[model samples]
Target: MTVVMVEEIDPSSADAGVPAHFGDPVKEQRLLETAVGLVDRSNRDVLAVPGDERASWLHTLTTQHLSGISADQGSELLVLSPHGHVEQHAFVTDDGTTAWLDTEPGAGAGLLKYLEMMRFFTRVEPRDATSEIAVLSLVGPAAAELLPELAEPRIGAVPGPKFAAGSVPPEATAIYSVRPFEGGLARRVPLGVDLLVPRAAKTSVIEKLGVPRAGLSAYEAIRVAARVPRLGHETDHKTLPAEADFMAAAVHLDKGCYRGQETVARVHHLGRPPRRLVLLHLDGIATDHPPAQGTPVELDGRAVGFVGTGVRHHELGMIALAVLKRNVADDARLTVGESTAAIDV
Candidate 1:
């Protein structure tokens, strides 16, 4: 059995008590408005795919058009099971012999397992590179401005992976631009600057710029608002590409035979996936107790589906993501535990 390890970085240590939860509503609002914030996403996993055939081998298994993606261009890809269930998702960047696959936290092991299983027929070698890298996301309107200062200002987007080699200040940090998941630019600046610098400098950067540090709480809120799907929450091994809204972005309908292309193409052309991902707003007794994963959602006393992710929004109240039966009406009523939520269509 192959072993894979994940490295998680604490936001507090990275940003001096920035509160990984971002508890204050006032501060949250300020952070959202400024369009400039530092988010410590050290929990996400980074896998390095190396070997002469890395790109070609990965292109054959994933759902993106990787053959067309160059080192200067990066794109997001989905890894699906033979039955069309989403097993993992990744943002890939290839520099010919080496490819970087950045995936959600706790996903690297499974991805590595899958890759290892597939490697017997290919020439690619997959290795866990999470520990060697630290990921810091700078988002909002100011993202573009801040990113270029640390790395070469590449005028491209990071849909898959874009690479630029640059240096950071006097710390000797290795900086590279990655495609942004949000509507801004992002660069992955590898902090080789003595582990202590990342922990100490994070705070100084935020304070000096007067920008709020975003946490998981705010990250979820913003992601849901943007209708961006979460890997383990809004998607899983049970979800098909179409059902998860991955068309054109993460899935390539025209790609050659992949693990689950048959089901993906059939379901997509049929115009009826088994389930639909929708947003919802819970009615009455709004609190932080959002519905758990797989909690039954109901409409007109009939079971439709289950809640995926729920957030207690200060303004929107209780908002959630749900995978409901395709036939459910737009105004469907969903029940989670004892609370009733209304689908926002």
Candidate 2:
């Protein structure tokens, strides 16, 4: 497994398939904002839920409303503990017979097992498809525009999240799916497209696209700017989806019953969440390494929250994403390690 760390990444470039950047991150960020940038998400794990009742059964298990989802439509799904604490989160889409769930690295096993345990009498059999599939992403405001340019699937018309099925030309049809979503990077970038291809064609497909590569640093900067909360990075063992503001993208309020729906709904509609995920622009970040994940965040010398993903942005300077006490003033000057922090409201 490849471990993504601030210290391990080089701002300049790295070996292919590594999370680090290639050449210049500032330019990569620019590409991500204006044109399009290539990102290797093969490290992400893909799980398949195949069966006659996959959609309805899996719908009842995840936070997203999947019972009525049509083929090629994409939605972010969250698996929460009984108390509404987030346990696993994945980017999900279907191809009529099966639902493909792509989640953070090394998290597919637990998610699959949980599905198995819940299948008391259901007709769903979850399979780990990571070995057979690979994920690549094309991001930027012009990402959707490049689909036809690259001779890829024209996944258009249907707004929100969509998955259009396509293939790698010249034969071989092992599930080439394209999912274009907005929340992956941010609103600044119009859309982000994820390509799921046969593992054997991953290399050939990327070369055919012929775009500049963006590393995890650039990806992190834009993600933080967009306030996209990752599971392990943003949430601990007890993180409620509302605390990270995930309900907007990951939860369906009137979709009927699901695990953890009570707490997710109560906090989002009836009551205020005790914590909030906020953007932090820091004064002092290491020249080579951003603050480590789980670094303490304080306000008035009192511990408030912990740091999540941190990076030096192309335009935002030293920035990070943190979840803080809801009561903390938006204008309050907070501290993280030796750096002074201000909330981006």
Candidate 3:
């Protein structure tokens, strides 16, 4: 078995309390936002589903249009509880014979267990591939140009667009790339492209690509700016897919019955989610540090919602994403830590 190795860096280097950075958080963020940046996403977990019933079985499990996705295409998935609360979020891709599912660190084991419990008589089989497979991410305007240089998939040349995707060409092996942001009409200049590579080849590919390494700070900034909600940060067991703004990317309204279809339908049609995710433009000049996760968000001196991920972008200044009451006005002023911030909805 191939073991994925994670190279650890000093935690108290750049932003002491924040996640470690490669070198300078500002420079790394600038690279990700302007030129190009790469991150070792091997820390994330991957689950492989292989068998004749893989496609059909997964289709009946999550909220996404998987039946129509081609062998080279991929989509994000939201695994909701029976009451529509989020249980898991995964990036899923199929290669005709096998389906690859990726999730946040520490969440894979639980996801595998859930899959097993619900599998019943289905022909699908789920196996943990985290030890054998690793993921790398590329971001910025230069991401597209740098993809073909890595591993040219059988799909041929990548299409022109900041957010474009397709399967790796069949002749290729060991690695593959996917346009994680493109999902039908929700087109936008995505944060980056994701490359799924075998664990044994991760180090070699990183050296071969020769892109600047970005740490968690830069990654968090870009993700928050893009309004991407991560598992523990923006989502948890109490979270509803609608509240996290995952409906567009991970939910398929026209799909057949799944775990939490009724609750999703009810919320989308008649009810309003208790809370909604929003980006906050913090008063960096007045704040000493970025608000930590679960920090209180006070409106008019009353607690409403709590903070999630916070980052200071190279050019964008201090920014954070928070889940606030759905009724909170778009222009409402909220307080975080010792400083005030505004919703950038």
TM-score, every prediction: 0.75, 0.83, 0.82
As for candidate 2, its clashing pairs are: none
lDDT of 1: 0.62
- TM-score sort, best first: 2, 3, 1
Q: 240, model 3: CA deviation in Å?
A: 1.4
Write candidate 2's Cα lDDT for 1-345 as tens digits: 233533365433222355666767787788887788887778788898889998889778887666766564566778999999999988776766778888887789889999889998998888999897787777876776665423233222211222222311211111133343221211111236777777777778778778778876677677888888887889999899878867656666556678998887677654568888999989875344567789989988999999988888888888889989889999999988889899999
> Which predicted model would earn the best TM-score?
2
Which portions of model 2 show Cα errors greater than 4 Å?
A: 1-17, 148-191, 285-288
Kindly indicate the candidate among 1 and 2 with the higher TM-score: 2
**Candidate 3 root-mean-square deviation in Å:** 8.4
TM-score of 1: 0.75
Model 3 Cα lDDT, one tens digit per residue, 72-137: 556678788999999998888776677888898878998999889878898888999988777777
- How big is the positional error of residue 163 in model 2, measured in Å on the Cα after superposition? 30
Better of 1 and 3 by lDDT: 3
Q: Cα miss at 93, model 2 (Å)?
A: 1.2
